[model samples]
Target chain A: MSERVKVTIDGISVEVEQGTTILNAARLIGGEIVPPAMCYYSKLEGSGGKCRTCLVKVSKGSEKDPRPMPKLVASCRTTVMEGMEVQNITSPEVKEARKGVVELLLINHPLDCPVCDQAGECHLQDLSYEHGSAATRYEFDRRSFERRDIGDKIQLHMTRCILCYRCVYVADQITDRREHGVLGRGDAAEISTYIEKAIENDFSGNVIDVCPVGALTDRTFRFKNRVWFTKPVDAHCNCDKCSGKVTLWYKGEDVIRVTARKDEYGEVESFICNDCRFEKKKTSDWVIEGPRKISKHSVISANHYEQLAPPPVIRKNPALKEANKEQFERVIRY
Target chain B: MESLSNRKKVLEQKPMTFGEKIYLPSIAKGLAITFKHIFKKRETIFYPEQERPVSENWRGLHSLKRDEQGRERCTACGLCALACPAEAITMTAAERKKGEEGLYREEKYAAVYEINMLRCIFCGLCEEACPKEAIYLDGPFLEADYLRKDFIFGKDKLVEEPLKS
Candidate 1:
C-alpha cells in the first residue's frame, strides 16, 4: 500500500489509499452520498466514460478557496488527489447540473420501464430515484429509432440507448474485427456499426451484457416478463474451455435464463461466450413459451412424469448436418 | 446544416407577464405531477443483490438446455446457426457410437454447438427453426462482460450443469 492520503467528503475527513476513485472512497465512508456512475466500474478493465452521471464538485482546501480543478469531475474515472474535497450532497450547482443531465437522458429513453424486462434491475430507475429532477422539460416528440439486431442473440433498441459506448469499445477490444462504433454527435450520437452492419464476432453477446439499460437485450427474451419474476440460480456456464459459475435465473423450477455472475469484478472475466448463451437453445423445448391458448372448457391431462424428468444438459458433441434454416419463414402468430 | 439566420422564423419568445414571473400556476401544476409520483409505487430495483422478475415475453441473454438423461439436446443440426440472421451460431455434428448411445438421444448429435452470442440477434429465429425442440427464447435481462471474449458463449460456457441427487 502506498501512502494513505487524507481527503474530505462533506465534513467527514478520512484517509484512503493513493489513486482511489471518489466513488470508492465515498463507499468506504458511508453516508447518504448520491454520486453515481452509469458507466464507471472500479474493477472494470476498460474506461468507457460515456455515461456522465458520475460528475461531482471538487472545491479546494477551504470553503472560501477559489483555485480548484474543474468545478465537476467524474468521480468514477477520476482519481483522488492528496487533499482534494468531493461535494455530492451539499453543492447546489452540481446537483442542478446532474439533474439537467438526467433530464436529457430521459428525453430519448423510452418511459417503457413499466413493462420493460429491465424494470426491476435498471440503472435509470435507481439514478432517477437518487438524483433526477422531478420534471422533464422536453415536450416535443422524442426521437424514435428502429431496432438494430447486431447479433443473433442481441437486439439493439436505439430508443433506450443513452449512447454509453461500453459495448462498442468492448466489442472492438475482443474481436479485433471492429464491426461496431458510435456514430453522429451530441444528442444524435449513438452506438452503431460503420455502415449499420450486423455484429459478427464470437463475443457479440457481451454488448448486451455491458449495456447499462435495456438498450440491448436478448431477442428471445423481448418483453417476456418483468426482470424481478425470475430468481437467479448460482450455477456455472458449461462452455468448452470455461465452465464458470453463472447466475442462472429460474422462474418457478425452470432455469429461465443465465448471465455471467461477477464474484470478483474483472478478476475473472465473465466466463461465457456467445456459443454458450445461444447454442443451448438448439436442442430443448425447455423455456415454457408463455401459456398455451386453450378455451376455458378445454380438457387436458397434466403429464407429471415428463415434468419429473431430469433437467436438460447444455453441452453436446457437435454433430449432425447443419440445418439450412435460411428457407424457414418467420411464423407470425396472432 | 443551415444556421437559423438562413431559415425562416416560425415562433418567437415573448416577454413574460407578471403571472409568469410569479410562476405560481406552473409551480402548482408541477407539484401535482410530483405528488402523483410521490404517492405512486416506487420503480427502482437494486441490482446484484436484488432483481425484478423476467416476464414470459422478456428477451434476455441466452443459455443452452439439456435432456432428461442429461444429454445436450442440441443435435448440432445447425438450424440455429442457419436461422440466425446475424450468422452467430456454429457447429460440428458427430455420429454417436453404439457403446455411447446413452450419451446422446439421437444417433446423429452435435459434436460441437457454439453460438457467437456476440453475433446473435436474439430474434428467437433459432428457437423458431429448431425441429428438435432444443432451443428456446429465455434468459437474463442483463449480460455483464469484463472482456470482449467473455461475451462469446461457447459450449463449455453454455452447457447445463449435472443434476443434484
Candidate 2:
C-alpha cells in the first residue's frame, strides 16, 4: 500500500493515499468543497487537465517546504503533497477562473438545449448553470457544423463537442478498435472518423455514455422524448459480451431507451455492450428492478416520488382521503 | 354561556307600530324604488354581441406563436408541461427533416402539442415557462363546448396562422 498523506481542503482535513490527485483527496471528504470536473474521469486512464473547470488554489505546498503555489492548478492533474492545504470554493480566484473556463467551453457550443436530448442530464448544462455568466461577451459569429451520423445507432453533433477527448479515450481504452479521433488543429479541431468509417465494436457504445455533452447521443432515442419525461428503472439482461447491468428508461410500458447505470458522479457503473444498448428495448428483455432513485435536485426527479405510501392523516380522515382520491389512484398507477 | 370574543349581540322583539302593521306604505316604497331602476343604465351587456374590456395583463386562452419568417417558434422542450400546475399541457416531439426549415424554427418541434381546457386553470405558468417565447395567453376567452373531447385543443387550434408574406 502507498504511504498516506494528510491534505486540508476548504478548511477540512482528510487523509488520502500518496499519489492521489487533489480532486480525489477532496472527493474522499466529499461535499460542496469538491471541485466540479468537466473532462476528468476517474475510470479512464490519462484523462485530465483538458478542461480547466476543476482548478484549485494551493495555499500550502508541502510539509517540509511550507510555501504557497504562485498560481492555481488543475486539481485532477495535481497530486496532493503531505500537509498540503488546498482552497476550492473558499477562494474567489478559483471561482472566477471556473467562470472564465465555462465561458470558453460555451463559446462554440450552441444554445440548443431546447432541442438537445441531453439537456436535463448534461454536465455542461450543470457547469454553466453554476459557474457561467448570464450573457456572452463574444461579438463574433458562433461556429456551427452540420449533423453527421457516426454509425446507424449513434449520432454525432460536432458543434456541441467541447473537445474533452473523454469519448476518444473510451474508444482507445475500452474498445478493441479505435476508429474516430480528434482531427484538425486548435480552433478547427473536431472528432471525426477517418474517411467516415463506422465505429463498430463490442464496447463502442460506451462512447455515448462517456460523452459529457449531447455531442454524441443514441440514435434510437433521438427526439423520442425529453430525459425528464421518461422514467428510469434499473434492469439487467444476460449478455455474452459485456456487463448486462443497465438502466432501462421507460416512457410508459415500453422501454424507449437502454443506458448503462450511472453513479452519483455521472459516470457509468459498468459499460454495457452495443446489443444491450440498441437492440434490447422491450420490457421482457431484462429482469425488472424497481424505480431508480434520482436526486431531488435533478430535473430528472421532477415528478418521481420515492415512497408512494399515503400520509397517516389521510387514513385518519375520510373527507381528506375522498378529496385526495385522484392522487392516491395516481400513486397506485405509478 | 359567556362570550369568548365579547362580540355577541342581543335582539329585542318589539310590538309593531300602526303604520308597519298596515304594510301598504312599505309596499308602495318598494314599488317606487323598483320603478326608479327602470330608467337607470343597464349593468349587464349582451356578452356575445358586446364584449366587456379585459385588463392589459389578462391571461386568456393560450396561442402558440410564429416567427416573422412564418416558422413555428416552439421547439417543445417540455418546460411548460413540467411547470403546469394543473397538468393541462402535453406534447410529443418530432425532428424537423430537410426542406422543412421554413415551417419550424428549430431542429426539433412539437408534433402534437395539446392543452385540455377542461383541466387548465389558465394561470399563465405555461407562458412563463416557455423558453422560445412561443406560447402566450393573449387570445380572447375560450368559448364553452358541448363535447368533452372538443375541450382538448391540439396544434390546429393553438397555433397562430402564419404571415401572408
Candidate 3:
C-alpha cells in the first residue's frame, strides 16, 4: 500500500494516499466541501487542470514547509501533503473566484438549457445555478455554430461546447480508435472529427456520457422528452461486447432511450457498447431492476413518492421536525 | 333530563291578539322589502351579449405565444409539462428542418402540444412555469364541448394566430 497523508479541507481533515490530489482527498472526506470539477474525470486518465472551477486555496503547504501557497491552485492537479490545509467553499475568495470562472465558462456557451437534452442532469446548469452570476456583462454577439451530426446517432452542437475535452479523453482512452479531437486554438478551438469522418467504434457512444454539456447528445432520444419527465430504471442484459448493465429511461411503458448507469457525480459507472445503447429499445431486452434512486434535490424526483421516509436529521431533531412539519404532512398525505 | 349543552330555552306560549292573528301587518312588511329592491342597481349582466370584464390576473384557457417574427416561441423545453400539477400538458418535440427557420424561433419546436382542459385545473402553473414565455392563460375561457376529445386543446386551438403580413 502507498503511504498515507493527512489533509484538511474546509476545516474537515481526511487521510488519503500519498500522491492523491487534493480534490480526491476532499472527496474522500465527502460533502459540500468537495470542489466542483468540470474537466476532471476519475475514470479518464489525464483529464484535469483544464477547467479552473476546482480552484482551491492552499492555506498550508505541509507540516515541514509551513508556508501557504501564493495563489489558489487547481485542486484536481495539486497533490496533497501531510498536514496540508485547503479551503474550498469555506473561503470567500474561492467562492468569488468560482463565480468568475463560471462567467468565463459561460462566455461562449450558448445558454440553451431549455432546448438542450442535458438540461436537468447537466453539470454546467447546476454549477451556474450555484456559482454563476445571473446575467452576462459581455456586449458582443456570442459565437454561433450550425449543429452537426457526429454520426447518425450522436448530435454535436459546437456552440454549446465548453471545450472541457472530457469527450476527447473518452475517445482517447476508452475507444479502440481515436477519430475525433479538439481542432483550432483559443476562441476557435472546437471538438471535431477530421475531414467529417464518422467515429464508428464499439465505445464511441461513451463520449455522450462524458460530455459535461449538451454539446454531444443521443439523436435517437432527441426531443423525445425532458430528463425529469422520463423514469430511470436499472436493467441488465447478456452481451459479449461490453457490460450489459444500463439505465433504461422509460417515457411510459416504452423504453425511449438507454444509457449507462451514472453515479452521483454524473459519471458513468461503466462504459457500455454501442449495441447496448442503440439496439436495445424494448422492455424485453433486459432483466428489470427496481427504480433508480434519484437525489431528493433533483427535479427528476419531483413527484416520486416511492421513498417517503423523512430524512434522518429531521427524524432525530425536534427543531428540524418542527421546521419540516409541512413536508412531513405531505408525506402523510401520500 | 338535563341538556348536554346547557342554556336551553323554555317554551313561552301566549294567547294571540287580534292584530297578530290577522297577519296583514307581516305581509305588508315583506312586500315593502320586495318593492325597495326594484329601484336598486342591477346585480347581474346579460352574459352572452354583454360579458363581465375579467380581472388582470384572471387565468383562462392557455395560448402558445409567437415571437415578433411570428414564429412559434415554444421550444418545447417541457418545463410547462413538468410544472403542471395535474399533468395536463403534453408535447412531442421536433427538430426544425432547414427551411422551417421562419416557422420556429428555436431549432427545437413543439410539434404536438396539447392540454386536456378537462384535466387542467387552470391554476396558471403552466403559465408561471414557461421559460420561453410562450404559454399564457390570456385567451377567452374554454367553451363547452359535446365530446370529451374536443376538450383536449391541441396546437391548433392553443397556438396564437399569425400576425398579418
Candidate 4:
C-alpha cells in the first residue's frame, strides 16, 4: 500500500499518493493552481515534462527535511513528497515564466484563428489568452508549411503547430497501430508519416483531438461550423472496437461534428475511434443524453442565438441643417 | 417703390392687333407647333415590353457578384450590414467546410443573407461597403410582388450563379 503525501499548493493542503506529480496534487485541491499544461495528458503514457508551462517553485521540502529545491521544477513531471510546499497559483515569478514560455511557443504559430476549426476549443488559444503576450517580439518571418492530408480523414496544417507532440504520444500509446511519428529536428521538427504513407489506422481520428492547435484538423468537419456554434450532446453507440461514448455537435437538425466527451475536469474518458469521429455523424446512430453544458468561454454559446439589435436610427446633424438653411437664404438673395 | 412699379408693368398685357384679336392666327400657330411633334419620334414607350435606357450610374435592384473562378467572393464579414443606412441587410456567417472550396471563395461564407427590399432604399451603401465585391446594385429593377414576404430577398435570389468555366 502506498502512503499518502501531504502537499500544499497555494496554501491549500491535499493528501495524494506518494508518487503523484505536483500537477496532479495541485489539481486535487481543485482550481487552486491549474498549471497550463499543453503537452501533458494524464491518460497517455510518458506524456509529461514537455511544454514547460507547468513549472512550479517548491518553497519547502518534505516532512523529514526543511530545505527547498534550488530551481523551479516542472510540476507535471515532478512527483510530490510528504509535507512538500509548491507555489503555482500565487507566484509572480511562475506567471512571468509561463508568459515567456507561451510567447516562445507562439513565435512560429500562424495567426489563422479566424479560419481554423480548432480556434474555439484550442488549448493553446486558451493558454495564450490567459498567459501569453498579445504582441510578439519576433519580427522575422514565421515558418510556413504546405498543408497535407496525413490520412484519408486528417488534414495537417503545420504552420499553426506548436510542436507539443501530444498527438504523437497519443498515437503511440493509445492506438494499437502507429503509422506516424515526429520527424526532422529542432526548428524543422514535424509530425510525418513514413515514406509519405497515408495513415490508415482505425483510431487515426484521435490525433485531431490530441492536437492542441489547428495543426491536425478533421477533414470531414473542416470549415463546416465553428465549435461554439454547434451544441455538444453526450451520445453512445455499441461499437466493437471501444465504448462509443462521444459528443455530437449539432447545428440545427444536422450533426456537424463529433468529439470525445470530456469529464468535468475537461479530460477525455477514452480516445474515440475514427468511425465515431468521422463516419458516424447521423443523429440516430447514437443515443442522445441531453446537451453538454458549455463553458463560459465558449464562443458559440455566447454568439449563438443572439438576436442582433436593429441598427440605431441615424439623426441628421443640426449643423448640416443650419448650413443648408444659410445656402437657401443666399440662393433667394441671388 | 421701384420694385412695385416694375411688378405692375410686368402684369400689364399688350393690346392685340385686328388680326390677333380674332385669335385665329395665334391659335393656328399653337396648333402648328403641336402638329410638329406628331411627325417626330415618339417620346413615350410601350409599357411592359419596352424599357427606357437606364443611366450608367443608376442604382437599381441589388444582385450578388461572382468571382472569375466562379466561386462566391463573399466572406460574410458583415461590413455591408454595418454600412447600410436603411438596416435592410441581415446575414449570418458559417465556416466553409471541406470540399466546399468551389462554392465559397474563403473559409468564412454567408450562411443566411437577406435584404428587405421594402426597407432597402436602393442607396447602394451595401454595395460600396462590400469588401469582397460580392454585392452590387446593377441588376434590373425589383419586380412587383403580391406578398410582403416576397420582398425580402434571401441568398437564393441574391447570390449570383457561378460563372461557367
Top candidate, metric lDDT:
2
C-alpha RMSD over true interface residues, each candidate? 15.9, 0.6, 0.9, 5.2
The lDDT per prediction is: 0.64, 0.92, 0.91, 0.81
Ranked candidates, highest DockQ first: 2, 3, 4, 1
For candidate 3, the chain B TM-score comes to 0.83
lDDT tens readout by residue for model 3, A1-334: 8999999998998889899999999888888888999899999999999989999999999999979999999999999999999999989999999999999999999888989999998899999999999999988988889889988999999999999999999888865667889999999898999887778788899889999899999999998889998999999999998889999999889899899998877889999999999989999998998678788889888877765577698899999999988888766654
State iRMS for model 4: 5.2
Worst 10 residues of 4 chain A by lDDT: A306-315
Q: A84, model 3: CA deviation in Å?
A: 0.4
What is candidate 2's lDDT per residue for A236-326, written digit by digit as tens?
8889998799999999888999999998778899889999999998888999876787888899999766555777998779998999888
Q: Worst ten-residue run, lDDT, model 2 chain A?
A: A302-311
Candidate 4 is graded, for docking, as: incorrect
Which one wins on DockQ? Answer: 2
Segments in model 4 whose C-alpha atoms lie over 4 Å from true places: A175-178, A303-334, B1-165
- How much is A178 displaced in model 2, in angstroms? 3.3
DockQ for every prediction shown: 0.01, 0.84, 0.64, 0.12
Q: By TM-score, who's the top model here? A: 2
True contacts kept of 4: 0.21
Docking quality category of candidate 2 according to DockQ thresholds: high
DockQ of model 4 vs. true complex = 0.12
Could you give candidate 4's per-residue lDDT for residues A1-334 as a string of tens digits? 9998889888888899999999888777766376878888887788878789899989998878868888888999999998999898688988899999999989999876656788778888888999998888999999998888887788989888887777888778754666678899999898887876877777778878778788999988876765765688888999888789899999789998898977544568898888888989898899987667676555545544332222233125666556566554544443
